[model samples]
Target chain A: MHILIIGAAGMVGRKLTAKLLTTGHLGGTPIQRMDLVDVIPPHEPQSEIDIHCEAADLSTPHTAPALIARRPDVIFHLAAIVSGEAEADFDKGYRINLDGTRALFEAIRHTQSYCPRVVFASSIAVVGAPLPYPIPDDFHCTPLTSYGTQKAICELLLADYTRRGILDGVGLRLPTICIRPGAPNKAASGFFSGILREPLVGKDAVLPVPDTIRHWHASPRSAVGFMLHAASMDTAAIGPRRNLSMPGVSATVAEQIEALRRIAGDTAVKLIRRVPDPAITAMCEGWAPGFEASRARALGFRAESDFTQIIKAHIEDELEGVQ
Target chain B: MHILIIGAAGMVGRKLTAKLLTTGHLGGTPIQRMDLVDVIPPHEPQSEIDIHCEAADLSTPHTAPALIARRPDVIFHLAAIVSGEAEADFDKGYRINLDGTRALFEAIRHTQSYCPRVVFASSIAVVGAPLPYPIPDDFHCTPLTSYGTQKAICELLLADYTRRGILDGVGLRLPTICIRPGAPNKAASGFFSGILREPLVGKDAVLPVPDTIRHWHASPRSAVGFMLHAASMDTAAIGPRRNLSMPGVSATVAEQIEALRRIAGDTAVKLIRRVPDPAITAMCEGWAPGFEASRARALGFRAESDFTQIIKAHIEDELEGVQ
Candidate 1:
């Protein structure tokens, strides 16, 4: 089986690509070829065989058909301009987030003779804050931010195109991948884990929103699992509504502290310092807490059972950098 | 106050334009100027000032800004390629329904610093077949047709823009205008009234759907009323979610036959010919049976009370056009 992973250099992208390579392929077809595409070509794999790692901005109209020429049986798209960056920069956001994503879909529509599973990485940001409790699978999407709006609009387009038989598409709107393994990036939510992980390792970190503020989260491992499952799931079951909220833990800032104390003893809690940034606080307020991921759950997607496991996964993966 | 009515040559457009001209302006401002825009220019009306009837294709990008330069205080956007035409011509549908509408909105967005009350002529087609009875105000839009999808997307953009204070917009998703006050066009649902209408005035017409099928409807008078009321509604009270379902009646084909029988006696019923079209049946199956237009009713947007009223309205309005 030939596989393509757009945005393959990103954190989750690396994990999913390695996992796919390890498992090799579906139904006994080994993934003989792998196409890794990003704005910057990722570090070359240490494999003897060929692996196509090309650096090109996929937002360009020509990029999609070029990628489609690879004829990937499974296309894992994890590329996007993150929320904070998107909100701050209108042109860059719309360019990469909206036009780029749309161009790919359009390319697929015109190029593909046989529909392939287009596994899209959506985010819970698609559903905005101050939401109805236990937000149902089919809640009306009222995104509060540009990133969320872009995701929601793309979801609509995906559903419509799938209905038109353009491509078999599924949008997995992932919860924020807590304990993201990397150096602290510019993402506003980076502080959620930074405050915890940094303190656990005796490093100071900023706390943006209050500990009492709530959010939905899944670990990086689970996000990769979601991609794998979405690739194999029966799309006919999902029908025209191609998007689903990926399962995740709904935890408040207080819950994170409590979990830290439970998993790493009181030392982790003491490492956390209280400081508030008004901008981050206001932005966080517009986000939703829990989504009743009924549709995704029924379709056999899984997540960490508890926040303690989230901490444990961090300890295992980033601590050792292991699968 | 000034008013502009696009598609002023169409049935609803002409009625609404005439009504507006006779009624004068909203908010106690006399409509000192009127602009009628269509591909086919409207008939010149004798006004002390001037009646500006312009020939233009709104689907092109340049035309919108050029039109908006008139800056009519109340703009009634009734220009559309209709359902059957839109469905058959994909490019034209996207060009007019999606691109044209977006261009118009963008034109409004960029033209100086005036916020005009844009009364958009949306349709019940935005909501496909509802599984649950009484489709609520916040039901997820799962449009089954391209025209519906385009309209639904425009509604979203309009709400977002209004929330951003870029435009004061109101969208009215009108129920199928029953006994549309002229010889039937090629719309699949045309025969619903045509069988009775064409025959009542001594002409043969087709019957395309089953008697069991039920759908929401309103008369041309009500459709015009919807436009006028939408144009004048307290948009500040409407808030961010500006698109609304106008009040309408739910009636089956059998009820329509009964309406014809009651209003036009046996002659109207006898004029009805039974020749079913599967294509219409398929299309109609994807239409909403009824709507919970509680919001519109509460806000004072009125439509025909029942099928009998619909038939009577048609007889009253269409008598002169009849042979």
Candidate 2:
């Protein structure tokens, strides 16, 4: 099977690449050739499969047509500007997220007599404030951010293109990846992972919002699993509604702290500092607290049931199980 | 107030123009100037207000900017390729429906210190089959047609732009305009108007779907009222969710025929021929039957409560009070 992975330089992209390489096959088909693309060149891993890594900006006019020339059997589109940046730069956000995605879809349509499976990484950001406690799978998307708007628009395009038989597409609206294996960043939602990731590693982390603040989450491993399943699963079941809200564990900030304490001892819990920033607090109120992702669950996608398993996954995958 | 009508040649646009000229004011403000634009030059009307008619295509790069240069106080964006044509030509549909709308939004954003109320014409096509009998305001859009997909995308852009303070915008998901005053067209939804219109005019009309087939509708005058209300209403009440399903009468084809018979007698009803086209029947099955437009109702947008009122409005407006 020939495969193409866009945004391969990002964290989830890198991890997904590692998992695919370890298996050396997908859906029982041997990986003969794979192309990894991003704005920056992706790391070349040691593998028996024929692999090529290239740096390409998809928003550029000619880039999409050039990428589709090889006609990969399966395409994973994960490239996008993060929420904060997209909100800050409107023109740049639409150019990369919206125009770039359309260019890729159009290129595939222009190809003669070729149909490939396209797995898109959508986000829960598609829905915004006044959301239900357990937002149902069929709830409307009234996104408040430019980033979410871009994702929602792309989801519509994905379904329309699939309906027209130009491509077979599936969009997975991934929850916030918790216990993210990296240094804490300044993103508004960073605290969700920081309070857990830093304390587990015997370092201090700031908690910007109240312990009562709840949100949906999944481990980095589970996210990659969703991507693989989306790429290989029977798409006929998806029908015209190609986008889906993925199943994940819903936990409050306090619950996340307790999970860290259970796994890494009392010292980890003490490392968390409660220095609330009202700006971030107000922002958190608008984030999706949870989702009733029953459709994805019934379709064979799975995730951790609680925060404990999520932390354990992070420990095993990122920390070599030292904790 | 200076107003711009993007689709001044369309039936709704022309009616709206006539209504504005008759009233000579909007939202308690005196009318000063008006600009009418379409793909072809709109018919010039005899009016006391300064009126300019021009031919323009919004999808062209410079067209939107040139139009925005004048900075009309209220802009009615009613231009689009109809559903049948959009489905037949993919490239043309996206270019005009999606790209054209985006271009206009961008133009308004680029204008310095300029913010105008933009009333966009969306459609019930945004939502498709498997719909609840009374589709709620929060129901997700899963459009089955290319035209619906484009409208849904534009609705997203309208909300995003409004939230960013780029422009004050309102998108009305207009129901099918019944008794549309025009020549019989090949549009699949044409039968909804044809059965009532041709019969009232002492002519024969064909009904392609079963009498039990239900759909949402409003008269042309009601549609014009919706545009006016959207343009003049206090948008602060709309919050971030700028798109709304406008209120309309929901009736089955049998109900419509009964209303026709009460007004035009058995002879007019006899003109109705039922010859079911399986293809059209399948298509109509995916159309929206009803909507719970509670939000638009609360915002003071009103429509006919029954099919009889719809037919009466058509007779009074289109037929000059002739029965």
Candidate 3:
């Protein structure tokens, strides 16, 4: 199988790449070659199969078509500007998130007879405020943020393009990656992971919101799983609604800390400092707390059931069980 | 106040223009100038206010920017390829509907200081089948047709642009327009109007679907009312959900014929011939039967309460009370 990964330098993309390499197969077929593209040059993974990596900005005219010209059998589109950056820079957000995605889809359509399996990285941000707890699968996407709006529009395009037989596409609306394996970033969602990931490593991490603030989450491991499953699953089952809200664990900040405490002891929990920021707090209020992702679950996608599993997965994957 | 009407040659656009001329004011301000554009040149309405009409395709590059250069206070954007045409011609549909709308919004954004009230003509086609009767406002748009997909995408853009403060946009998801005046065209929706219109005027009209098939509808007069109301209504009242499912009458084909019988006699009803075309039947199956347009209703937008009123309004508006 010839595979292509866009935004392959990103965290989940890298994880997915590692997983694919370890398996050496996709959808029961042996890997023959792989292609990767991102704004920053992706590291060329050590694999027996022919592999190529290139740096490309998809929003630029002709970039997407050039990437698609290789015509890989499977394409994983994981490129996007993060929510914080997207919200701060409107032009850049729409350009990369919306225009770039549309350009890729258009390029795929231009190939005429070639219809590859396309897996898109959508986000939970697509669902906005005044949401019912455990948001149903059919809930309308009324995103409160620019990033969410861009992702929602792409989801629409994905479904439309798939319906038109232009390409076989599946969009996975990934929940916030819990216990994210990196230094805390400026993303508002960073706190969700920082409080847990930082504490385990004996680093003090600021809690930006109250312990009562609940949000949906999945580990980076689960995110990779969601993408691989989406890449291979029977899309005929999904029909015209090509997007699915991937299953995830719903937890409050308190629950997340408790999960960390259970795994890493009270000393770790002590490292979490409470210093509320009203801007982040207000923004979190409009985010989805939970979801009834019955459709995705029924379609055979799985995730960590609780925060403890998410934290444990992070330790095994990121910390190499050092803690 | 300066006014711009895109697709001014369309049925609803022309009616809106006529209505505006008669009223001579909008949003409690005296009319100043009116600028109209369409693929076909709009008729320069006889009015005391300055009026200019031009033939232009909004999808073309530089067209929208040139139109926005005048900086109209209110813009009524009603341009689009209808359902059947859009379905048959995918590239044209995206070009005219999606790209055109985006270009116009981009033009407005480029103006920097100007934020006009933009009333967009969306459609109930945004919603697809396996739907709930009296479709709720919160229902997720999963359009089954290309036209619906285009309109839904534009609605997302409208909301996003409005939120960014580039324009004050109100998108009305108009139900299928009943009793459309003038010649019967090849539009899939043409039969809905033809069955009522041609028969009332003592001409035989083919019924493409069974009488049991129900659909949502509003009069052309009501559609015009919706545009005017959307233009003048308080945008602040709508919050972030910029689009609304407009109020309309929901009736089965049998119910529609009965209303016609009541208004124009049994002779008018007899003129309807049952010629069930499978293509139309399949198309109508995916359409919404009704809508719980409580949002628009609460906003003081009104429509005919029943099919009888719809028929009467058509007669008074189109037939000049002769019927």
Candidate 4:
């Protein structure tokens, strides 16, 4: 099976590539070749699988068909401008996130007669704040941020493209991937994990919001799981609209801290420091608290049960390198 | 005050133009100048108001800003490929519905010191199939048709553009306008009014679906009311996202028959012939049975209370020329 991973330089893309290579199969289909593309080509993964890396910028008019020439069977499109970047720079955001993504879809559509199964990496940012209760699978998307707006726009394009039979696609709206590896990043959600991940290694981390502030999350392992399952599924069941809200664990900052304490003792808990930033707090206020991904579960997609398991998954999967 | 009307040759456009000219002011703003453009030139409205009519197909490139040059205080953009034609032609649907709309938006954004209240005539097709019982104001949009997808996509663009301060816009998802003035039309919903209108004039009409079919509806008067109100309202109350699901009456097809029974007696009923089409039945099955337009109502926008009011509206408003 030939599998393609767009945005292979990003965190999830690199990890997914490494994970797919070792597994050899996704949902039982054996992986023989892996195609990777990004503005910056991905590094080599030490594995038995054949890997082809290409440097391409999708926002450019001509890059689509060039990437589509590989003729991969399954494609995981994880390329996107991060939320902060997209929100701060409107032109760059829509150009890369929206147009670039559309170009990729158009490229895949014109590639040969056979359509590949596309696993699009959508985000919870697609569903922003001022929500009603726990957002169900059927809630209206009222995005407040530029990033959210861009993502929501892409979701519509994906749905319409799939409806037109241009591609067999499934978009996974991933929750904030908690306990993100390597260090506290610049993401708005960085603090949430920072308060947990940094403290585990006895490093001081800031808390931008009150402990009561809640949000939904999934582990990186679950993200890979979502891509794998989306690749394997029969899209006929999804009908014309192909995107799915991936399952997530809802918790506040305190709940996240409690999970850290439970798993790794007081050493992990001591690293958390309270330093509130009103800017971040105000920004997060409009975001939806949680999601009820009943449809995804019904379709056999899964996620960690709660924060503790999410932390457990991270430790077992990510912290092994540290040890 | 300057007013621009896109798609000025369409049925609603003609009616709106005639109505505007007869009443020279919208909410007391004198219609000093009226600029209109469509694939064909608009009919000359019989009034003292200055009417500048232009014939230009919006699908062609670089024509959007040419309309914007007039720089009207209010712009009523009612242009789009109709449902039947849009479904029949794929490329044409995306071209006009999506790209053309985007171009118009971009055109307005590039205007020098240009800011106008954009009154967008969206449709109930934006929300299709598998609705909640008496669908709430915030119900999700799962459009089953390409026409619905296009309108929904434009709504997002409107919201995003509004957020970026490019334009002050209001997208009214008008319920299927009943008593649509004109001869037999191609729209599926046209049959609803056709069966009633043609029969009232002693002509036979086909009722394709069973009398059990229920749909959301508003009169042409209500639709006109929505645009006028949208043009004048304090869009700040609407915040960044300016589109609203305009209030509408939900009634069964049998109720339509009963309303006919109440007014014009059995003569109106005798003109109707029942025929079943499985295609329409399957199509209607997924349609939203009803909608709860709380936001629009909360903002003082009102649609007809019932089908009786809808029929009465048609008689009072449309019958102006007949007598």
Candidate 5:
């Protein structure tokens, strides 16, 4: 079966591509061909299967229809402007995130003959301030930021398009990924990973918020698992509410530090400097600490039970278990 | 203050126009001018204020910016394709409901000088099936219908635009309006008003579902009141959650009929005819039976307390108190 991966140049997309290459199959169907797309041409992965890589902006009018013409069996839509960038550039956010996503859906609808399983990467940022601890699946999306609003709008469109039989779609409101394996990115939630990732690698990291600041997280490996499951799951079980909040380990900054101390000793913990930036702190305040994720969990999606497991995944996958 | 109503020909828009004309002022500012826009030119209200009536489709290019060029102090965006029509005509729903609203917002943002209070008429359809009784203000919007999806998308945009300081926006999720003072339209929820309205006016009304089927409702008078309150309220008190579920009476079909019995006795009630329609009954089951509306009420937007009051409102306003 042919498969398509949008945003294939990003961290999750690259990892997912690697995972698919290793598995050699998805939903028990032998992978015969794959198409990967992004704003910049994604590095071609070494796979026996036919892999086509294209650098195209889906926001442009003809790009989406051109991509859909390939008719991949499963489409993983993981592309997005990160939280900080979207919040900073208003028109860019709407153009890339909202209108771009709608264009893709419309393209699929025009296909008229095929209904592909489309898995969308939504975000916990969709929920705004004054959050309840372990927020329920049904909590309203009052996005505090432009990026979150775009994600929320896409979720609505995803559900609607799926309901209309234009495409079989599922949306995963992924928690903030922990131990993100990369250099520091310009995301406000970067500290959630930087404090841990930097310390383990013998580098000092800044803690922008208080140690009491808690958040939900899952490993990069788990996120790939979510996409695969969403692609294969019996959608009838999901009913009309196609979007689900994936389960994740909820941990405070102090708890994250403690986990680091247990694994990499006090020297690693000492690398975390308590230098508060009020701007980051204020943005962190609106983010959720945890989620019920009852619907997602009930549907059989799983994640690391704790931050320690998350760190372990990064060590094994990114660090080659040399820590 | 100059005022603009986008859907001036509709019931709530007409009522709000008349209400503004009656008051002669809004937020203690004298009414200097009014612009009424719709698909067809709205009938000129008998008022001394300078009125500009335009028949324009907001979805078309240049229409929204043209409207914004008028520089109304407050803009009531009450235009939308109702549920049944949106479900049947997918393209029309997205073009008119989603794109049109965004165009108006973009026009305002481009102006960059003025920020007008934008009051949007959203619907309870934003909340989908398997609902909890008295759904809270923050319940996630999983719209089951295309109309609902479009409304939910607009609500997200409304909040985002407000946050970016493009416009001072407030979205009201109105309940099924009871005792509508016009001919039956194609709305799936039309029967909610039809059953009460036709029977009271000494005409036979069809009941599509069993009396046990309950739904949320507000009278036309109450709906007008909510818009007025939203136009005048200090948005700071609303915080970041711009979309609110307006307060209304929660009653079963039996309760509505009983209220009619109380107001106009058995004669009015006897005009009601029970004709089970499985299609409508199936549709009604997915609708919200009630809402908590705690936030809207706290912000001083009031509605009729019970179905009895709703019936009285229709009689006093539509029937000239003769019923």
Candidate 6:
């Protein structure tokens, strides 16, 4: 099977790439050729399969058509401008996130007699504050930021394109990846991972919000799993609603701290420094606390059920099981 | 107040224009100037207020900027490719419905220190079948048609632009306008109006769906009322959720027939011909049956309570009480 992975240099994209390479196949079909694309050329992973890494801006005219000319059987669209940057620069956000995605869909449609399975990486940012305790799968999208709006719009486009029989598509509303395998960042939701990742690695991480603050989360491993499931699963069962809220562990700051303590002792727990940032706290208020994700669950997409399991998955995947 | 109506030549637009001209003011502000724009030049209404009629395609590059250059205080965006045409022609649908709307919003944003109250005419087609009996204010948008998709996407843009302080926007998800004045068209939803309208004029109308089929509806006057309310009301109460489902009368075809019988007697009701087209019947099953519209009702947007009142509205407004 041939495949194309956009935004292959991003964290989730990289992880998904590594997993795909390790398996050497997807859904019982052997991987023959793959193209990895992003704004910056993705790293060329060593593999027996034919792998092409190229840098391309999707919003640029003709870029999408050139990429689509090869007619990859499955296209994994993981590209996006992050929430913070998208909100800061409105024009850039709409250009790369909204127009870029639309251009890609248009390219696919223009290619006569060619319909690929498109797996889109949507986000929980699509819905904002005034949310219910556990957001249902069918909750309306009222995103508070430009980034979320772009994603929500893209989801509508994906479903419409799918309904027209131009392309088979599925949009995964991925939860905020917890214990993210990266350095500290200024992203408001970064603290959700930072508070745990830093303490586990013998580094101090700032806690911007109170321990009572709850949020939805899943390990990066589960996110990759969701991507694989989306690409290979029978889309007929999904019907017209192409977008779905993915399942994840719903935990408060206190619960996350407790999970860290259980894994690495009080020493790791003490590494967390409480320095309240009112700005970040206010932002978190509008963030999704949790989701019902009943549809995703019923469709066989699984995730870590609790905080401890999430921590274990992170340790096993990123820490080489040494932690 | 200076006002611009983008689709001033269309049915709802004509009605809204007539209402505005009759009042000679909006929100206590005396009529100053008005711009009526459409693909075809709108008929210039004989009014004391300054009025300009122009034939312009919004999808054209400079059309939106030229309109926004005037910087009307209240912009009623009622332009769209009807559902049937949008479904039949893909490129034209996206061009006129999606890109045109975006260009208008972009033009508004680029204009320095100018934020108009944008009253966008959205539709209940944003939601599809497998719907709740009374779809609530927060039901997810899963549009089944390209026109619906365009409206849904525009709704997202309206909310995002509003949140960013670029424009003060309100989107009204208008129900199907019943007793729509004019000759019966071939639109699947046209029958909803046709069954009542043609009979009221002593003409026979075809019913393509069973009497058991129910749908949501509002009169053209109420639709105009919703637009006025959306433009003049204090948007502070709306907060971040800029789009709303307007309240409307919900009735089964049987109920509609019964109402017709009450108003025009059994003879008029007998003018309805039952010739079920399987194609339309299948489409009707996926249409919205009703909506709670609690938020719109609470905000004082009103509509006909029952089919009888709806027919009465048609008589009073269109037939001059002669029917």
Q: List the residue pairs that clash in candidate 6.
A: none
The best candidate by lDDT is 2
Among all windows of ten consecutive residues in candidate 1 chain B, which has the lowest summed lDDT?
B127-136
Q: What are the per-residue Cα lDDT tens digits for candidate 4 across B139-189?
A: 777787788888988888888888878889999998877877679976666
lDDT (0 to 1) per candidate: 0.79, 0.95, 0.92, 0.82, 0.92, 0.94
lDDT by residue for model 3 (B1-323), tens: 99999999998999999999999999799889999899998888778999999999999999999999999999999999988889999999999999999999999999969999999999999988889998988899899888998999899989989998989999999988988999988877688989899988899998999999999999998999999999999989999999999999999999998988888888988898888799989988888999999999999899999999988888899989878
Give residue A188's lDDT in candidate 3 (0 to 100): 79
Q: How far out, in Å, is residue A4 in model 1?
A: 3.0
- TM-score attained by model 1: 0.90
lDDT of 4 by residue, A1-323 (tens): 99988899888898788888877898788899988888897887777888888888889988878777778888899998888888788789989998999898888777769688888998888765577657888887777777777788788878877887778889899988887878667777788777877776668888889888888888888898898889998777876656788898888878888888887788778777788889889866766678889899989899999888887787788778352
Pairs clashing within candidate 3: none
Per-residue alpha-carbon lDDT of model 3 for A21-118, expressed as tens digits? 99999989998998888999999989898899999999999998988898889999999999888988999999999999999999999996899999
Residue B191 accuracy (lDDT) in model 5: 83
lDDT score of residue B165 within candidate 4: 82
Model 6: CAPRI class: high
TM-score of model 5 (CA atoms): 0.99
What tens-digit string does per-residue lDDT give for candidate 5 at B1-323?
89999999998999999999999999898999999999978999888999999999999999999999888899999998888888999999999999999999999999968999999999999999899998988788999989999999999999999999999999999998887889987667788898888888788988889999989999999999999999999999998899999999999999998988888889988888888999989989988999999999999999999999998889899989987
- Candidate 1 clashing pairs? A129-A286, A129-A287, A129-A288, A211-A253, A211-A254
Question: Over 4 Å off in model 1, which ranges?
Answer: A26-28, A112-114, A128-130, A204-212, A276-279, A321-323, B46-49, B199-205, B265-267, B270-279, B320-323
Off by over 4 Å in 3: none
Q: What is model 5's DockQ versus the real complex?
A: 0.94
Off by over 4 Å in 5: none
Q: TM-score of chain B, candidate 1? A: 0.94
What is the docking quality class of candidate 1?
A: acceptable
